[model samples]
Target: MNKKNVTKEKKTRNVIIIKTNRKKRNPTRTYETVSSNHYEMTVAGEAMHVTIERRKGIVNSSLRLSTKGLLVRVPLDLTEKEVQDLFKNYKDWIQSKWQDLLEKKKRQKNNKGMIYYRGKPYQIKVLIEDTIEDKKERIHIDEEAQQLHLQLQSTEKSQWREILKEELRKKGKEAILQRIPELNKGYDYDYNKVTIKDQKTRWGSCSGRKNLNFSWRLILMPPTVMDYVIVHELCHLGEMNHSPMFWYRVSVMMPQYERYRQILREEGTYMARIIDEVELLE
Candidate 1:
């Protein structure tokens, strides 16, 4: 290749796009589906649409609920009537779970000051310190109490929101730094920098320079889901694209990765909305 072509190839190889962050929020059950079998079901007196999908590797039928609608994934051999029968068998259980989801949405809508850490929500309490003699600021995280107390001096003028944001960044960076090494063990994954950014749309990204970059928002997810993102970017160090070979390597490192992947696909947008006050999404 000529010098210009060589540089272009080099750029193409190294300039990988950031990992996709699905931030589309769908509070209602309206969604576009190609499946002609789409139909509506009433659970908890709320109408939601349902769609059935068949895949080759699926051995048993599975069901999940999301804002878009209910999805039933079944093995290729499973007929539509069989799926209906499965739902019939689990009717009561499905209604209970769907009711719980609606209740959670009610809480989220009314929540004023809350933060999510490691897949759990903690209430954020900003208060003027009543106990400090010198009037210093401190953050007391009561995990057991499920609260973050931001005690600021009477004269302190910093935005408590910024303070809390910085605190989250520190915690996120610490967690990512700590977990990467633990997950990287037993593997020959090679990479350069591990940057934690306030990425609005991506859980993680890997560059052609072999640098690994992750969003601090990932700290909001469950640890297993966070680890999946880590292993995903690390896998790119060996294979640069989302080819089958790359997934095989990721599977070798984290066998249950797909379970977390599904969680991300379903709840990622909701998670992104959690502490969205300071960093508003467009």
Candidate 2:
């Protein structure tokens, strides 16, 4: 028997650090401190928050941007002047990214938008009505009208959004459960378990234990695309990695798998954005 030795690869940390000697500048510049560990600076007329995080493994300084604010990771050995200078050098890049994030947030605030289900666009309709049921129920999908109706007693947008996600997850779970068995028939592989998850970046993952994890957002994709993802993960049951044999197994089940893969590569980010915006409504 030939035994295969597989070594797990460590993922590289995404840390950006500037470690170059800086030219001497005006020493009289004043900086506004937000807290003991945070510094506030005005760049291009926009307020940028700088946070300093000290850690053991990090050898250099790094800058990261998010919706909340900017984070700077620096080694404990560096002086405050060095850190401030580093921030000044990357001020332009920081300002650009901050502006971009603000624009994205503005766009995401408009949650009254269309969502795709099974390759069809449906308008989201929030219906507020008093009902006997304490829990939010009576979710309806009008296929003929191409609208997803969320019947909720609470007029709060956040509450309605959560209810809608729960309803969608339920629907997604049902669809995955119904489809997996049909696809597994006649196949030699015996899957141990199947689970639906509210994943952000991944569509599906297969464990060595024969357990399959699928994203609930699969319901938002076209039927063909969803089938491709299912088959792709199922193929992993036979071959754990994306070898040529794995592709062969996937192609046997889905001949046009490449087409669907291309579609996902192009539009997957947009779909993720839609899901995130809906769930993150304030």
- lDDT tens readout by residue for model 2, 1-282: 001111221211223445433322436543332333777777656676767776433344567776677787665555777677766766677777778766756655554566667666677777777663755455677999888777776655557666767777887888888888888773667898898999856999999999999988888888887888888888899999999999999988888898998777655555655855654222
Q: Report lDDT per candidate.
A: 0.69, 0.69
TM-score (C-alpha, index-matched) for candidate 2: 0.57
Q: Provide TM-scores for the models.
A: 0.61, 0.57
Clashing pairs in 2: 16-62, 17-61
Worst 10 residues of 2 by lDDT: 1-10
Q: Name the top TM-score candidate.
A: 1
Candidate 2, position 106, lDDT? 62
- Runs of candidate 2 exceeding 4 Å displacement: 1-112, 132-137, 155-157, 278-282
Model 1 lDDT on a 0 to 1 scale = 0.69
